[model samples]
Target: MAAIELRNIVKVFSDKRRGRDLLTLDNINLDIEANDFVCLLGPSGCGKSTLLNIIAGFEQATSGRTLVGGKQVERPGSDRGVVFQQPTLMPWLTAIDNIAFHLKLKGVGKAERHHRAMEFIDLVGLRGFEHHHPSEMSGGMNQRVGIARALLMNPSVILMDEPFAALDAQTKLEMQEELVAIWQKRRCTIVFVTHSVDEALVLGNKIVVMTKRPGRIREAVNFDLPRPRDITSPEFNDAKRHILALIREESTRLAQAS
Candidate 1:
């Protein structure tokens, strides 16, 4: 059985001022197998983030079903970890404290929480900075803390919505490499939402392209290129070209329709 399943999922929102309902997702069907790294790639406003939110249980689909580990997803649970675009770490809490905050809420003793959180802190390469507050860290470092916090939960799936979008080019590249390494080590299912074709290509073994507003899956492209992918190679460029063509084709179709 697939690790995650989406069967004819649809989402719509009320546009109160406009006196009409806006459809954001239209029948998004997908099956993500265990340990699959899937990237949802699309243009802006394509509902990629919305789809991610639905899977994270932050939003309910207007219709159809979302299942994870053979169970329906009704609300946010610890079985799924989510990392947003912003690190969203507490400004006052030190890195280690923030990462272990969930454990604290569960009434775990400080020593035990520290022990468990330290494992994730090391996993995310934040050993030396564990005592620093979010304000004391760089954007990349704070994001690392956020990732550690999520992983500390030891969830079966990780859902990320453009978590690296805010970093500088070099920092973003470094984080990407670290994330790929972490994912390889953990071997967990991940559904990452991003608008960048290159980012998707670099991180995902499976890429699902979505159409413009009222999003639908255009195609699910299997990318089996080896790890530490060469972005300039023929295979990489070929995949990029194909993905771009799909986006362009969708754009042109929408333009013509309008």
Candidate 2:
């Protein structure tokens, strides 16, 4: 069974000033298998973020339905963990506390919460910084904490919305490698949203590209490049060429329309 499904989903936002409803997502259908790493890739304003939010249950679709683990997603829950673009950690909470906050809501005890969260902290290589607050951490480090917090929930699926977009190149690469390692070990399904072609290529086995606003699936491409993937490899270049061409065409079309 698919771990996540979106059937004919649509989203429209009211433009109160313009006095009209602006369509953001067209009727969309997607099925994500359990343990799959899927990336939603497209140019900015393509509604990829909106799609992620719907699956995360942060926003409701205008029509159709979204399902996670065979249940309709009406609201956010611990079953689907989300890591946003910016590290949304609680500034007032220490690293360990932030990671354990979900457990706290579930009525887990202090000693147990800290003990459980410590494993994920160590998993994300945040070993010595458990007691540090968000303000004390670098952007990448804070993102690591955010990831750790999501992982501590042991959710079946993790939704990441451009979670590394704010990091420097060096830090981004490090985090990507770390994330791949974590995914390999954890076997969790991930739905990652990003506009970066290379980021989607590096982290996802399947890539779904969508159209500009009022987004519709342009293509769902599958590539089996071996890992750890070599960006310089001939196979990698071939795949990149194909995907880039599709995106460039979309860009040109949009530019002409405007």
Error of 2 at 207 (Å): 0.8
Candidate 1 per-residue lDDT over residues 107-211, each given as its tens digit:
999999999999999998998898999999999999999999999988999999999999999999999999999999999999999999999999999999999
Tens digits of per-residue lDDT, candidate 2, 1-258, equal 799999999999999998999899999999998888899998788899999999999999999999999999999988999999998888999999998998899899999999999899989999999999999999999999999999988999999999999899999999999999899899999999998889989989999989888899989889778779999999888888999999889879989999
Best by lDDT: 1
| TM-score for each predicted model, relative to the true structure | 0.99, 0.96
Best by TM-score: 1
Minimum summed lDDT over a 10-residue window in model 1 is located at: 123-132
lDDT of each: 0.95, 0.92
Write out the backbone clash pairs for model 1: none
- For model 1, the superposed segments whose C-alpha errors exceed 4 Å read none
Off by over 4 Å in 2: 255-258
